[model samples]
Target: MATFTTAFPRGFAIEVLDVYSGPPRIAFKFRHWGYMEGPFKGHPPHGQRVELFGVCIFHVDEDMKVDKSEYFYERGNFLAGFLSCPVMRGN
Candidate 1:
């Protein structure tokens, strides 16, 4: 998370699209978006807005604290967004 903070200094906005289940087990779809205004993995920022969509399943204990979580998403697609650089002026 810290690494992402530096990459997206303005922060990623997260939205829960839908809740599929509740209680001890919870499932949901989500979207997170942010601008690449800061360095990412040593790569310079291109100031491009990026968005990621995914689903997650979480298991909670009796106390309602998350005990485990599983996240599914297109890793390659997300990484590609960062690797793509904007065309520099007069380059």
Candidate 2:
């Protein structure tokens, strides 16, 4: 998280879209917006804008400490936006 924050020093924002809590478990859906100001995934900052949405699920132990976490997001969308790739046409 700190690495990403440092990479996008110009702007970075995360908006929580939804959250669900259950005993020992929690889930969060969020949207992330960032502007490239430094290197990311071997690509130097292009001053491009990137937006993506993802979900994070967390499992907590009896002691209320996070034991596990998972994240899901679309790699293609992020790469396309960040690299300014041409849109693909469906067959």
Winner by TM-score? 1
For candidate 2, give the lDDT of residue 71.
Answer: 86
True lDDT of residue 32, candidate 2 = 83
Total clashes in model 1, counting residue pairs 3 or more apart in sequence or in different chains: 0
User: Global lDDT of each model?
Assistant: 0.86, 0.76
Candidate 1 per-residue lDDT, tens place, 59-84, comes to: 99999999999999998777777766
Q: What is the lDDT of residue 9 in candidate 2?
A: 89
lDDT of 2 by residue, 1-91 (tens): 7768766887678898999777577899988888877776555666778888999888988987899988899988766765642222221
lDDT of 2: 0.76
Model 1 TM-score on a 0 to 1 scale: 0.83
